[model samples]
Target: MRILQLHVDFVEYLPVKKEIDDAEPLLKNEKELIEDTVVILTSIENGDDETLIEDFVKETLDYLKKIKCNSVLIYPYAHLSSSLEAPKSAFKLMTQLEDALRASTDTIVVRRAPFGWTKELGIKVKGHPLSENSRAIVKKNTERQPGTLVEVVSSKSDAIDNEGSVSSALAAEKDLKSNWYVLTVEGALIPYDGYKFKKSEINLENLFKYEILRKRTVEDQPPHVKLMRKLGLADYEPASDSGNMRFYPKGRLIKSLLEQFVTKKVSQYGGLEVETPIMYDSHHPSMESYFNRFPARQYNIKSDQKDLFLRFAACFGQFLMTKDFQISYKNLPLKLYELTRYSFRREKSGELVGLRRLRAFSMPDCHAFCQDINQAKIEFLKRLDLSVSVMEEIGITPEKDLEMAIRFTKEFYTNNKEFVQNLVSKIGKPVLVEMWDDRFFYFVLKWEFNFLDNSGKASALATDQIDIENGERYGITFIDESGNKKNPIILHNSPSGAIERVIFALLEKSAKMMKEGKTPYLPLWLMNTQVRIIPVRDEFIPKCAELLDQLKTNSIRADIDDREDTLSKKIREAETEWIHYTVIIGEKEVATNSISVRDRLKKSSYSTSIDELVKLIKEPMKGKPDLPINLPEYLSKRPRIAS
Candidate 1:
């Protein structure tokens, strides 16, 4: 059983609908309000029985006494656990638990929200640290043997995270202390507070505040969330778990292009692309230890009495694969890349926003195995350049759209100060520095490029980590020149982070432009419809089709606006879709064998030949993937997916 306990000023709930066939009949389906109560949002999980009732009551009474509250309300909430008990059994247990709580203390009043009913909930929890807490109540095993398998769920909200297993690194990270600095291009580490900011350094300063203070909980949805839906990119999937999204056709096309581009860049950087499984055995020796090494809540599953877990990164599979291969130092600096279609991380419900953070996302992960630290350093810089180039080609420039942050232990900085300074000099800007007193994670040095949104939240994009562990942990060995087997140092690099986050950054950047009273636009290559060809008259429909054919021949995504609407309205709709160029076909254009084109970005219109229009559109698309339009060629045939 899992429970999220909240001490609220008042909890107001109304039964809106019955979610289960065995839903309890309510005396009154009106709003039920409880004041000055300890509300326990409960999820009854498998294997829970009367054995847990005593402990549950004891915990509840202790909490009430601690808070000096005499009132309690039990609310059945299903989202707290993926593994749920049967509805009938769960309802009975919930009622029995409530009865036990009431029978325990004469001075306390106990109430329960109707079970198995869909209800509208309103809660105002107090702002104290003890006001919110979660717990997983399991049947205690007194007769457990040595070396027996035991499943333990965590209770840390800010550290190890959630009910699932958390990494030891993440838990240590919570208590890790660091001194902040701004590393300049001239190789001086100025204290963060001592460094003065320039007008152009606003984003960097925002990144400092976001990282140093570590305020990641988002209060309101960012501007990109609305724009994502308004532009037909993606939306939250209500049918699935929170933080999982459904992408429309246009969004799919954009994601495909980005995945293709990032893969191509990695391949050119000597990475050998490979595929890996989405799930692994949690009881496996390597997985068991590695779980606490990297911090994230995982989705656990039970199959045939064996414990399994969904992967949050491509590291496990890739490392296991490399461990089985016979390699030598000649093959050192071996790079393996995988573009994971879906990596699962059970993020906190409160932090699950649009595409910025997700439970499942596509990640372009690449790992390089090196002979030693020197080789690792060389490969790290190469991957950094590759990441920078990839971002630049994707229209997100490092100097303008991103801020650099490098984190390391004090020992690393003291030993390799010049190497760290070179990284800042390479980016040609002052970077945020976090120098830890001790090493906690597998990586001794790490850096990432962050994009600051309008709400001052920093989202990491391109990143690389110089990991000194995991090789030996996974038992991967490469024969050295002296014929001795040695573990290789691994480097983890994600050139563009999650594909969904790239889209979020693009949308956020456009929203930022709109906020500045500038025209908002997507990169031409990413636009679903690069050009829209509209017919001025019914006779011009045939002419517009011919022009579209020409545009298609040159690999331009052009669509015909053949609907029976005024030419002005058609053009306005095209503008709303952010079509780069709108071509209108009419008598003047037909007679002269030319087209009247409206450029959305330039806000200019002029007559140009079909060849010139093709060249104009194709110029900026140089070296980029040429994908056909995702929607139909005629606008009239396309369904409205976005508002």
Candidate 2:
């Protein structure tokens, strides 16, 4: 079955004549109009039978919910498919689809056009990002030719074909035997299905549905997609691969600051920063072994008759480097850190949406080589704190903005129950726990903080893993005090999962605020233009420039709206741009040497001296990295990058 779904403002159709002998009886020959309806132009192809009714209805209902409309028009359009079902059979399935849809939802109004008829159709589709979609629904075929493409039914309403090489761990991830539980801070292990949730534990429940249940309803692009483009942060790069993004100047500035901040934080915690090549030889023994151990797809390249693949994480490079080092128990816990500028992961195409998930991303990967499990546990806690602190500094509060999930081998949890409980206690909440019967990957234990977005989807943010096999697998060893060389335990930590994902979380958070009738603004420290200076008249442009100079001298990012627009329009533009403070200069301000300021966050206007405004902006930015404005200081000189 094939369908073209559309959200239309109004659709009109007229049954002129019957195109087939099995056409349905028409009650009216006049034109019919339905306003604000979901139009599904469906085609029932050969082999499409009664089995498709349930899925078709469910997909229609999901689409209705996403578009916030209750009316649906299921039109039987034969042009959608080349090989159509027999007219009599197609009519029966079409009506069955209509009946199933109406029975599934009480509020939904389902309507259908006459099957096997030539009709004049008119539709004015909605202009939003998710107004139109195409889907192909087909039955499973167990047998196929050698070169045939594999078609996988998407978890969402649509269908997608699987591509790229699947790693052993990635395949194991789909079939990993696990028991799910909710581990409370008080050390109670409640079955995930039986645990009672509090009203405040909505995000926890969402994490359960995302991880254990594997349920996703919102198929359209997330709220952050629109916000990313509107706010001029980032956008899809059509010239590149699906998951690669083109960051605007503001986006680059934000990315740069986050990189600096995270690197500084890791260094403060005793991590020796290092650099590594972004690509590695695919035929290398260690690379080939490690690829199957990790659950990620690689971007393969052929260079000079040698096969090379992009690195998905810093672990391989750091592990290979450490394998060559000579160390003793005296240097038990050696930490190496790298802020990978472009870690490449060939994520499923359907999963590529804005900055939430990207093919190329910056990851702050830190590895700690430990002598034993005991040492690894202690370092893990410290790094967990570091993760929490880093996210908090980035304006994503843990336990509020993030939900904790801990995955471990059942044997590890059995021997180290207190250690596992300590982690939940540190989070101060009941966390989702997945315990496997056996270790499928190198990590014996791993925990991550996930941000549940406005949609029901959850994305992992800060994560760390305690790898018990990687050191031995890579031949990285340390000599103990007893003079025996042994493989050291490796702990992989990404304090901030990926810099691009952090921006996505911030934008998604802002979208939530907007939905709740609040003035959404970025963190003051991350704003590209901390303060926007607007001259009320052309004569006051010099005064605005002086104010900009003063702000620059104080290390505050300030830009002048020196365009020829009216004062109100300039102020509105500043607010739309999410500028933290808008300082309006005119005769009154020039006469008094004070400025009128509009704080976008506060949504109020006040008068303050330039020194006072500078101090106000600087206070919140004390510990954050500062960078000059990435765009032109004057508004007139700037190009319109975002619509």
Candidate 3:
């Protein structure tokens, strides 16, 4: 926001014809309007926000106080800056500036002329050092200014963000926005070449070369959503609000598998499963405070004259549970976890696309209460590993599929430098860092594992925040060795960030493969039909059924393409569904006790026995829970998700 302050002896301005569509409806009569006032030429820019208005007004009042002036006139002049905001946004800002000026006790009368109109002005200049002064206010660097007053209520998360985007960009890539970090796997912050990452052949690195920035528009659908609809996984439901997606049988099955896997992983990491209310009193002091602290938007509900907000995450739920628990230092690092099926976040309409961004999602929220910062670090590392393992199990290769980002306060960096360095070392990659001078949230440090999608916009898949404030806010305390009440350092973790987004990421990964002339498919365990058994003729139908039963008995998700379609058409349909393996049976195969297998991943066909095929599918799926195929076993019985 740029402001040109002209401490004039007298200024007169008359509004002329509108130059823009959003120009204020004001007419200049035959008589010219004149005023003896100090004129303020304001230019609001793209990045100006709600907090900016408060800060600007405070600064303007200070200038007014210094110059011993109480009357001021605001003039919206776009020529003060080349980078002007949208006309609507600028008009709103000018009104806010005027309102704030009027609210101040220091101002006798404050007024703003009509905005977005050509104006004829005459002014008598006052020649003094303070008479003509220009000020450039940048939202980014405002944090450094001690006197700058920012509205924490409106700009809670915005205060820490680089732009409107929350994710950090890659540090090495200039085109990407990222956080800074000191990564150390070998006990110190090391360079990228110091240790080799366990990079998979995901071939995701080349995506960064394209500089695929975000196109934030509601009409532009993500590529993964199209594929998701095609695969009968999920699609947007018109009955629900935007960002609310309905999962078909296949999509729900995929979501369930991920949910079950993440839940078990959290349990293994010492988290005790807990469930909390879906809605809480909005008037609750603690609830309201925490609402402002967290970055997510909320859905408000009015029931029986009481206002309530839907749960955005499990923070309040788990925290409220801990507040009632009779915990000791021995149970200090108590992990409470929940897999919320319908967690709600009011994401903007333009930001909602497929599962990548959703208003309603299944969030796996885990909070670990530690005795101290040291114990919290230990638990944080454990949750981080759990997140990485879940990703790898779901076929998303770490470092290849996701990037890590860390944000902390200067206090944490100064006091616990080695601890943070140890984290980077374990990950073996440099992470983006967002540093704050003062502590904002409960946690001094927080990290997110980000998934960059096909559209080049990254989403936080797995995230953990070290909260130092919530324990005290909720009165959640543990008995110390001295039997005294002590606030436990809370670790807010979502090991698998959101269930839908994981599916989205997997879809995006497959999309990337297809773009590179490779077959696109979900993981075999998560697919609606892992294997399709096809018969050569009607006589072979019984043989195909026999094979399907055998495969299903071995826990393989198998189906039969029993539609009376041509053999070529059936094979084409199987290929399109991305069925991992296609088995064809005929007189030759039945006599020889062998089946011709078309391997989608290998892009090759070979004859293999039923026993060999089961072994191949089960090996990779070992130890992973499988969801039953939600679609009909026979293709003829199933309806098409996409035309």
Q: What local distance difference test score does each model get? A: 0.87, 0.85, 0.75
Give the least accurate 10-residue stretch of model 2, judged by summed lDDT: 157-166
- Between candidates 1 and 3, the one scoring higher on lDDT is 1
**lDDT of candidate 3 over 1-643, digit per residue (tens):** 7776766666666776788999988754332433445678788988787777766777788778778777788888786556789999889988988887788664367877789888776665453435655566657555566545432122222211111211221111112122333354444443233433345412222222222322423335678978988887888889988998988888888888888888888888888998899999876777755544452367878899997879988888888888899999998788888999789988767768778889998999988899988898888888888888888888886667777767788778889888888777767655655566665456688888777666667678888898888889999989999999999999888887889888889999998888888878788888778899899888898999999889888888888888888899999988888888999999999999899999988989999888899899999998688677788898889887764
Model 2 lDDT at residue 196: 93
Model 3 TM-score, 2 decimals: 0.72
**Candidate 1 per-residue C-alpha lDDT over 19-95 given as tens digits, one digit per residue, 9 for 90 to 100:** 99999999997999888899898999987898889879988888899998899999998877778999999999999
Model 3, backbone clash pairs (residues 3+ apart or across chains), number: 16
TM-score winner between candidates 1 and 3: 1
Candidate 2, after superposition: displacement of residue 293 in Å?
3.5
- Which one wins on lDDT? 1
Q: What would the C-alpha RMSD of candidate 2 be, to one decimal place?
A: 15.3
lDDT of 3 at 143: 56
Model 2 compared with the native: what TM-score?
0.74
Error of 3 at 56 (Å): 10
